[model samples]
Target: MSAFHVKVKWGKEMYPDIELDTGEPPMVFKAQLFALTGVQPHRQKIMLRGATIKDETWDGIKMKDGVTILMMGSKEEDVPVEPTEKTSFIEDMTEAERNTMLQLPVGIKNLGNTCYLNAVIQCLKTVPELHSAIKEYKPKQPESSSLLTLAVDSASLLTLAIQDCYKTMNSGKTAVPLILVNLFRTTFPKFAEQGEQGKFLQQDASECWTELMRLLMQEITAKDPEKTAQNFRTSLIDQFFSGEFSCEWKCVESEEEEVTKSTDNFQQLLCHISQDVKYLHTGLVARIQEQITKKSAILDRDAVYTKKSKISRLPAYLTVEMVRFFYKEKEAVNAKILKDVKFPIVLDIFELCTEELQKRLLPNREKYKDMEEREIEEERALKRGKPGDVIKKPKTRSMPFSFEDDLGSNNSGFYQLQAVLTHQGRSSSSGHYVSWIRLKGKEWLKCDDDEVTSVTEEEILKLSGGGDWHCAYILLYGPRILEVVEEGEETEVETKIGEET
Candidate 1:
């Protein structure tokens, strides 16, 4: 049998030059690991890209030479042969105390002012597509960055660190992303260099989000020989987050028919502060209809330009940055707009679209409305002690002009709130960032550095910013897909794509 070398890491130690035959069962590889780490094959759980490799042949897993795989689970722990019987009493604890004792929260460990990174990571975790992308990543070549001072390559370290964290989270374990933090700080000298009293300072959450997203995009394309590493500017961010605006420019002496038509792209939807604007939908709609005038290129006189943007292609996850910070010339600081602009759990952007795009969206909107009405009727019937008929939602089909081939395509203009990154201080430079993520309906988790606690839907509504407390700075909304059900299937069925990856 032909054997190839691979690297295996168990805890802090890496065992290199481990050879295994490609045709052999995974148990054969585990047997060798057993000799090195004193861990039995049954107890060992081998993982690749945040997924557990099954106890099958290497061929089944597409294992290649020099592949780095994560090995979890420990050697057998010593347990007592005899058990000590103890008596329990009702007075042992109060109901609240017992519930508190039963709770075990999963969270990250804070490394200085790394709460911003933590908050962003927790928020991004809510995206199932991103999770799938990270799991499907396979390194094509060895990282060869000599600038890295760490024992391992900077890129590989960051990738493995994040993949390991994802794997741990999937296994329901809490861990600190220590390796990623170290490499991130090292790669960006500004992040590591900037601080007060010789300590790392708090960083902006959006900046962190952008940097991490860039790295992830690069990793996604690294395995393909045809494609090179891509930055966020050229990757899915542009494909999905981008919106197109049609600009009609007319000269001062020009007629209506002689106007020039151009297109502009925007990555974020700005929520302009206005007196009557209370909801997110209203602010976005207002921004899309504004007109302005500027000096024409050929004609040195002023020209009227009317610009209106409509999303031509919708990404699975839409990121909306609340434009709350503005530079103050007199004070030499960034001022915050603490307007309580209330956002919705379900946001509809159909009205903001062009006439043509609106026509394309109406079909899906109608289907979604019908699904909602049926669900509501079912709920009412259940409340009235009447058996309701099981209805199957229509399966999603492909669209020609969609954003990308990736998952998370928003067929309709409807979106549901997935995550929110909030800031607590007055200035952008100095503020605490926390992540409020929607786990499911009416259930949210508040991730504040090393602490994570449950919050109500009411608490999320209050994050719109009216006080000195944490306010929603960045909102991430994902497509609200119609729930897929089957006839005679009374139980709710979760239709998850790319679960294997």
Candidate 2:
């Protein structure tokens, strides 16, 4: 008899490489599971080979090594309630004990309406690459740069200050980086200026995002250019957060056209408005949909030019800024658009791509469509099945072609939303900025200054701006990579069964 290793998953927990003897009876396996998961042997259902394992020899079922098994049973145990003779009230607890029980996360103090900066800090923490880069960062050629010079140079101070804060966050201690705050004030003097009672005036979240991204690009080091091209992979921000556009300008009078290419090297996608703003994807598609009239190119004659734009490159991460704030000359302030523009958890941009790019993305799109159909079929069968019946799962295959350098590129022009920066108020200069960050599955976190709390997917969907509540101002979308199970990795059991992790 030989022993085999397999993983057993119960809920979110997984136990990998659990050894089992093939010579042992099914009851013996249940006993082992009972010890590991605290599930009664009789109540536990060991599923393998498309049927529940019974009290038969392991050889009778022909279990294989390196296979996964699903063990389903209630982990909760009921405890009988008893009458309490004595109870402690809140007033009875010691001060130290109460402090331990009510521990709070370290938060940045708002230096007079600095919520914009605070919100930005909390959101950027979600980027793992940024965290790692800041941790490994070193101030190169310090002798070449003086503190006075660094203070004047926004890039230098911003880099040092950001790295300092990141280091503090990494230390697992809750502390604020006052140095960073001062550096930010120095960089943007307008923000440092007092508005009311020594408080700073509200700043735009989009501006904060832009400035931070610019500083990060200047401070963060990129990998060797030659190696990146050779491997078809680039740095995280450049690989995913950047986009390229090809532009053509034609003069109406001369009937002459000039073609030029421009790149959004700074990781920001501008949202173009249409007649009625309903969905985010629609507005984005409209941005590159057609040609628009521009200022006259000729000085002597009244001649106009038509400018056409098209996307040439798609990054791993997409940043879309809703053009909600426009300068009002009469009001002398940026006006806000309260229009409710619905967005999606999963956004497809195939309609916004160039013809050749769309052709390249079709293969992955088809694969995803087929997978969706298979999943639906499985779900339908599951709905019709009786209780305790094992429902089979559909297997997924990989796409044929994808970018070599970037694993998370939108092979099929599909994106999953990762973060949203929202504003709640009438004007950009007066609204309260908050950061909503995705926290695994349908759960999200709302970071409003020092306060952080869990939120639902429904709440996130409602952020599409209608009233005074927080409206989505900036949206960050990440590529949804297609999952391809290897041939031998997933095979139907001769008798038809399932695998779980």
Candidate 3:
């Protein structure tokens, strides 16, 4: 590795032998990798059509007007480059690499771009037969210009195409034994920029795209399709998501900040259609469908998942906000024996909490066996207590807010403070139950880190609007809950805003 190098500041300043394999050299490597997108000029080849020099000889390292010059490959070929904009490169998955990185496993993403790229490359590298078959084909196009963007679009294309092929394979149809980019090149050449310029005076390659697809399926994909797809998929994941690479979550909120906000657009599930994208029809369709679901707004909205709205499927933009909502309710509901309760258990402890709620309402026999004992218990508690004054706050069903009270009670390990506040979240239809107890900053901080997901900083700000929402009612037998109930005699339960806490 005796390659000397010079690190020249592109815009501001300049420098003159730089280490090749290290330092600024890495930038060169990275730039080249980035350029690998559309310009698929073989790994070791160079194809610079138009340049200012009489020849391609630019000495040592030179920086002229925001351009960095480096001797590339066999001859010192100077290439102009720039760091890809962060926004352009790392698309904020709310919106929006190359080989040397692959050393591990990937997940079953509907469309993991990295997986697609790795899989397609592996599929191609492992099976040379696939290449020979593809070499016989070329892209056909009504117009040209599309050819120019091939390199830039390769990543998206490869992933999308592989996904397509996977979908087709899933449909019980045979798929390519190797990567299908060639098939994409052959079948959708118009899209791939391979335009029908046959090796020997192209004679309109193949008019029927379908026929090309048929030939591809018959010859390549159909060969041990499943293994090919699986192997390709496995190899891909193993290569990309290796080690040391992980995401860290820091609450966009700072300790000093009073409020936080986050905007959660659901576009993460989108798979941009790429010109080079090639995959089995079955897999492709399945992926697109799955993606449609993953980013679906209906799902993200945490709306009372109606079967009808879900029929069309939700888009990615709205899906981000649907964090925890899915599994949270199930976990909460499963926390206790929710059904087939002893009505007697209900009646035994009924008056201890609130007598009004236990009244004529359905006992949910399936939910409770008896209710009288609980009613009597409540009657006794009320008897010990004075005639409670019920504050009448007319129920406002329109707003997404509610206030409820629960009385005092106790047990062994920790007294049975049983007031569980159940209220519908602004975005949810079903009521969510949170212990009305007020949590400290530490707890909120923990929630900030764990409970929150997908919602963006911008969105959170709007919802929270600088308030800690740091309050609720959680006492098992606080004076609040007992205020509405009377003696063993029945009484009315009313809600009032001015009522004292």
Candidate 4:
């Protein structure tokens, strides 16, 4: 039924070599083999030629025209024992295999000997507990990313050691590529099953490579070979976020404010707020990391930890909070100390988190769903309107609409904010500002910039449609922040902050 390569000796061990037959081409190797053979293998394992193999049946093929070959008894005791508990060098293995196989070169995150991972890697072989720690960090899911960390900070040192005894076809002058190639070869097949990420991988690989190269290039050219890579990383980050990604600011306690405070209540508030915010941020990051661990499409290139010591100044060029205090009597409410992820990346970690959340939340949106048929026509009209092209006013906006609070959980203290019908063609302007907000809580809760200045009707009208308007700013604060004060002519509770982009 099928072809076979047989080394037959009566009463001797059955040594085997396999060759495909039944006229099966490599691509059709599996399916054709099944059709030819009346007997099929019990289990399937992938072979190098994209063929699936099962337990071989000598009966399925002719071993020298049905000559009965006797085999020696199974050598159960001679079976190889798998090593556990530790890695050991055996004389049987070659040198290159030991270095290239055991020592992962590329994409291994070399945490500055400054971090805890270094200690873990150093003691992994020696200590069982340390080995377990390493195991814990490995990705449990196929879709998730494994943490790219090194046991030592100086992978280059490790590289040099390997270089002295063994040579690898190392290029790019960095050990990263070698490491990445091994990783890619190992993991790419697992992911290629779904076939969704091929395009993204192709696109991201070049950009990421260029980014790394550009960073290294600067340091080499400046005669500061030492600082080149690190500086390049920093510069890449700066460039990416220059004008991309709309970010909204949330206030955290400033360091100067933290150190100056002698009050116990003040300290407690900071600790509590910090704890809450930290919990939220940590949960978000964990979800992202978990995804990276599971998906191969996502590279856990790096986990960015914001430097906690420094203060955060909002991006330059966008002057949002020029006039600090909003809401007249409200005390300090600002994000003084800034801590956030440093790296700008589109990792699978983020993607998996997004997918799971969307499933649970039912937030799937088809592309361009928000565009109306009329809106599409309008866009077409606009595109055609070049120089000397007459523009047409949009169709009538006389449709009626109303707003209702999503009272799903009233206890959430969150309101269901929506838009309502405004008066017909009223010349008066109404505005909703979302660019930024000043914390408008009591002396205990507010972060520095709390007082809001009152503006006239004309000033408000001009920028009501400034593109960033959202529902309304919601506040949950103690009653102390609700004091009424008569200022100027009007006694309005001015809680808005100066506009920021």
Candidate 5:
């Protein structure tokens, strides 16, 4: 059968309307009960119709609507009790203790002017699929010695180094990406440039991000070969992080020339900042349609052309780079723009897509709106309930925005900001970069080299450029998930059905 609601009994408490999906293992259901009853999943002993439920399957037991499940377990406290009753401050705790209490991820240490690399790595780690692919990556030995084969080996070694770095960070210690940095510098010699003081020069984080993604795209393939063949995207980077743009170029000098159409793949979108551009959306719109000089067949010589482009495909993860730096001829440096450009927490790019894509996005957009409204109504009902009343949470199901055949494409043009990399100086070469990552709800983690701290949504919004303060340079946005729920008016069900013996 499909998913259905059931009642769970634990000691003197009764949780009604606990939805269980038969497709998933019983352990998942038990985990859900664990959330409500505070009992560990392994310790939860569930019984239905006098038959003990196994962790793997629900074989002989038949389930229906409103069935009763008896669960027996006790919540274990993991933290040790303090001897003294005095208040405890975070400053008094050790590094491990502080990280545990704040739920912050480990930071990366800088090896002299390596903040750009650290910031880019931290931002990219937000994509769990990338990490999974790296773990499973195994490069083949080169059969014959060639430049191409050596390049492949280098890329593979870099991927392995990144995997090791991630493993070290997961151990709750500061990760020093020395091997990864060496591999990166060897692959891209420009990053190895040194100043007069024999110190490595600082690099642009956006450029570093682009180069790293390019390497990953070359080395990391999809986990399932059959699925990859059917989808035509061989690499996980292409499947999850690449987008397609459709463009039309028309000659402005010769009206009789036919408009040329083309499509191109891009891993990131550039937002050009100008005096008229006060918001990110405006900058992106202005960047997409511009005038260029090209050779026209009708006019033999170089002629002005109007290039208009629109997004034909969107990926699960979208990267946007702010064009805040420009090369100065006199200073021989990339000067930074300190103009403030406002961005949104939730961005909707429906207007920036092709007509066909916009039509495909409507269904999921409407479903998302309906689910949000239902959640609001449920919250209002909970507030109206009597004091000390326990309300059953509404059941939610994962809804994919893309087509069934497309594994990692986004059908809905809605995105939520996941990570932001900001620069804190006037020049790209001299500025320091930091990564701000969203941990959950309103909580965020700020990683500045080896220092990691917790911040809020309010602080993240202030990162928009204005002056010498930290200005958002690169933004990583993930698809906004839509959890579809059943259509029914929630009523106040009694919390206690019957007292347990």
Candidate 6:
């Protein structure tokens, strides 16, 4: 019976009133020491008096209440410190070593039910322009003058927190966005809602994405002010994520009423899921034209109207949200639809645009086709050429996909899928969220909380909602850039306004 309470001293810290049982192996005490300090049990060296403690048993050791024991060890370092010696280069390493050195991007740790926030942050980080904006954001002192001023200050602080988290992740360490999570809870009180057990409840990922964009819209502005002078959009969110719809409203019941026309701005496109919708394009098309009951001026009463909307302006980065959750009266919850919907890697919205916008998009569409054909021909010629033979490079041509006057407006209605935020559960309120981001050509990264793995293009296509597996909730699409190569210069990729090179 050698059970007694003792104090352990490690480095400058001391653990007081630690109960130890000698009946159990000495390894248990080392494990307790490892828990107190970050050092592993194997690395821990415990000393009682002048004798070293054995891991097998406490044979010759005699301990009393309040006895002080010395422990020494250091926790393993996650990020390597700068070496005092010569730096290693990738060219000096073998092929296998080089492959090992190339690591995937780090992920964010989930704080309670913050997977929705983590997933949205990862997907948004893939946008080069957004990342640059966050890096450049300067925080100001808190202003308590008015509600609007307070909101702006909060948004600025949130942006800085996100920048700090990104820096930590870039250092090859998994980031815990503790400050950002707190700021988000403060800014949007809805996220602070707790469960009956006093724990934070899971939320919808799409809702989190929308709220974050709203906060960013308040703080992030365009990098170059000169380019945004002619356009109505001055904020980065407006320039990169906003789109305009040309809408026409016609009274369905009153045939004599005149059709009214209007324009509406949208941050993201909603893809409404229904029994008739099997493809993403079809769902979006169905959403564009719908019947609504509203007050009519000619009828002077509530009447059914047919509203038709067409894309008048397209942004550089297109956000499409899948409307999978619907409110059920019986359950009083946002239930999810598990129907499978197909989405394409390359999306063409030529048919979904206004007639005038469609006309303007034809020239750039033709240029993209020509570039693809030329690239195929060059590959064939390279395969046929002999060693040391030089194939003449094609002359470079200007391919501007963005409109000149409207800084971030896309001239061509074409987009490539960039990132996807997915949810896995039966309902929106209780589910796991994960982010899948495209890395270079045909390669993808699946970020599940603090675990990140490499995935292929074929694997990404299977995320289109089917069952209990991951379902695509939100999809982010970036403009498909056309690359042109010059004889004397390297190939250049075109980008939208405010985009980093």
Error of 6 at 474 (Å): 0.4
Q: Is candidate 2 or candidate 3 better by TM-score?
A: 2
Candidate 1 residue 497 C-alpha distance from true site, Å: 29
In Å, residue 225's CA in model 3 sits off its true spot by 22
Give the root-mean-square deviation of each candidate in angstroms. 11.6, 21.6, 27.9, 29.5, 18.5, 12.0
**What is candidate 2's lDDT per residue for 130-157, written digit by digit as tens?**
6677667654443642221121244554
How would you encode candidate 4's per-residue C-alpha lDDT over 20-127 as one tens digit per residue? 343332222222122222111111132322323332232233333223222222212245678565665656545434434544221122212111111111211122
**What lDDT tens digits, residue by residue, belong to model 3 across residues 1-501?**
323333422223233322222222222332222232222212223212222221213324332332333222322233769858564232322210111122111111211111222222222222223334343322222154533322223333333344434433333333332233343343444423323553211111112222332344333322232332122222212111111111112222223322222222111111122332222122222222221111224233322211110111111011001011122464442111121111010112222122333342223222222233444554465445444543432222121010111001111011111121211232222223222211221111111100212223222222311122311111111111111223354444463322331
lDDT of 1 at 414: 85
Error in Å for residue 144 of model 2: 7.0
Q: Which residue pairs does candidate 6 place in steric collision?
A: none
Report the C-alpha lDDT of model 5 over 1-501, residue by residue, as the tens digit. 767777778889776656777765575565455434546455678999889999768899798988988998888645687688677699998775588566579899898899999999899889878877776666654564332212234576677767767766776778877667766886788998999989999998988998999889888886554543253387889888888899999998988999999988888889999899999999888977899998877789999999999998888889999999999999999999999999899888888899988998887788788777876876675667766565555566678755565777887899989999999998999979999999886679999987888899999999999988999999999988887764574643344212110
Pairs of colliding residues, candidate 1: 316-408
* C-alpha TM-scores of all predictions: 0.68, 0.67, 0.16, 0.15, 0.75, 0.74
Please estimate how well model 5 matches the true structure, expressed as its whole-model Cα lDDT.
0.80
lDDT of 6 by residue, 1-501 (tens): 567888888889876667777865675565445434547555678898978998767889998888999987788645678779787799996533343467568788898999999999999999888988887666543353332211124566567668767866776668877667876886788988998999999988888888989888878877565664244466888888888899999999998998999999888989998899899999999888899999988878999999999988888889998999999999999999999998999988888899999998897787788778876876676677655555654557656657776667778898999999999999999979999999887789898888787899999999997889999999999888876555576654443322221
lDDT at 40, model 5 = 49
Each prediction's number of clashing residue pairs: 1, 4, 88, 30, 0, 0
TM-score of 2: 0.67
Q: What is each predicted model's overall lDDT from 0 to 1? A: 0.66, 0.66, 0.24, 0.22, 0.80, 0.80
Model 6 spans > 4 angstroms off? 1-103, 140-152, 229-231, 375-400, 487-501
lDDT of 1 by residue, 355-452 (tens): 77677677767767666876686556445542343333334332322323322345678888989999999877677889998867667878786567
Q: TM-score order of candidates, best first?
A: 5, 6, 1, 2, 3, 4
Give the Cα RMSD of candidate 2: 21.6
